[model samples]
Target: MTDQDAGPGPGRTPRLPPRWFVRSAWVVHRGYYRVTGGRRGLWRPQPDKWGTLLLRTTGRRSGQEHAVIVAYFEDGANLVTLAMNGWAAPEPAWWLNLRAEPDAAVVMRDGPRDVRAREAEGEERERHWATFRQLGTDVDGFSVRRPHTAVVVLEPR
Candidate 1:
């Protein structure tokens, strides 16, 4: 379980890839979007699957724009995603920025959207997490590796 998940027997979680590999992948993914002028990077969320979306947030300290590709799904008019950081220990920078300034933007297959970010709480959090499980995301398994993770909800603003 990558020396993280706590369990009696063998952990169900798979060993995560190396940190350098994960970071490199993120850079490449963003590069692909820019190189293609976003013609090929954005994707739509499916009922039974998560989809890719480019989330843009303002830097908390620098006040500059930062973007990241994250997996998300529709929850009615809102979009929901996990701050997974590729299953790494550190929180994703995009999520950190959202925490600082809730207002953000996203580009999906449909078009761009302005959104306000907030943490899903209590029942809401459980419901969305359940949806992730149902979609075969193995969220619980992956989350065992982190001390805490945020279930972020992006409401249209």
Candidate 2:
């Protein structure tokens, strides 16, 4: 199997706890958002409002669409998200699904739109990293821990 297929190992186990935390927070936030009609503004405490966006990507194996909310940073006309938390691991499930099917949909606070997912590299990655660092203050120590991060840009279709 390739390195990606090998999945997480012993050294990566600690990262799992953080992933669980993020997932639980997402669940609670979504529930709160539904309860408040998206007015609570308790989802993400960041500058830019950085509110959660629901991304729908096709399942790699099941060929069905799966939707999940994630924190995102905007760049001009593109929407960017990082694979830093367990959700953003080198072999994250959503990232893998996007790889299999780049076309997806994103529902932000504004509205929903069809988008194409692409992994950012070189200068684009650097630019988004800076933006994320500027907007994400709650994620303390994220920069130190996830220095080598992958940026995924979603362009509207």
Candidate 3:
């Protein structure tokens, strides 16, 4: 089966590692950050429609800060993230970290914002999922993934 089809199997879980890939991606991302002086570069689109941000949160176990790139959707007064990737089932490390410690920080072109993370439910989940689809194309199947895929909402703390 392909990576996307390889849902969670026995003893298999979604994880972000493989040291080599992580390190290489980090190097490239860091270089992009430096070249842009933390303003905008590789990741940011000229007229960025979908809000993208750098999330910083403390590790639950290590008590250290971790940062990641994530897309956000505005929900009245909150921002939401869609944890979708074309590989494996189950949540990723970033979502796990947020669950462990809801208090987090986000940096966008506008500025930094203190936020709290929570998984969306019921109508809220459906609303944000629709907004997510409007922000991009070819993600119609995201919400249907059900209990596995989650809409993580981040509100001002």
Which candidate's TM-score is highest?
1
> What shift in Å separates residue 31 of candidate 2 from its native position after superposition?
3.6
Across 1-157, the per-residue lDDT of candidate 2 in tens digits comes to 5433343453232223455687788678768766887666334325655646878889999999886777786777888887555434355667789989999998777777899999999997877777766774334344334545568999989
Point out where model 1 deviates above 4 Å: 1-10
Winner on lDDT between 2 and 3 is 2
Model 3 residue 36 CA deviation in Å: 2.3
Error of 1 at 76 (Å): 0.7
All models, RMSD in angstroms: 2.5, 7.2, 6.2
Off by over 4 Å in 3: 1-27, 42-48, 85-87, 142-147
Clash-forming residue pairs, model 2? 83-88
TM-score, candidate number 2: 0.71
Tens-digit per-residue lDDT, 36-151, candidate 3: 87776323323325666788888878989987777675667687787663323556677888889989998876778899989999998888767766776334443334357777
- Lowest summed lDDT over 10 consecutive residues: which window, candidate 1? 1-10
- Worst-scoring 10-residue span by lDDT in model 2: 7-16
Each model's C-alpha lDDT?
Answer: 0.88, 0.70, 0.68
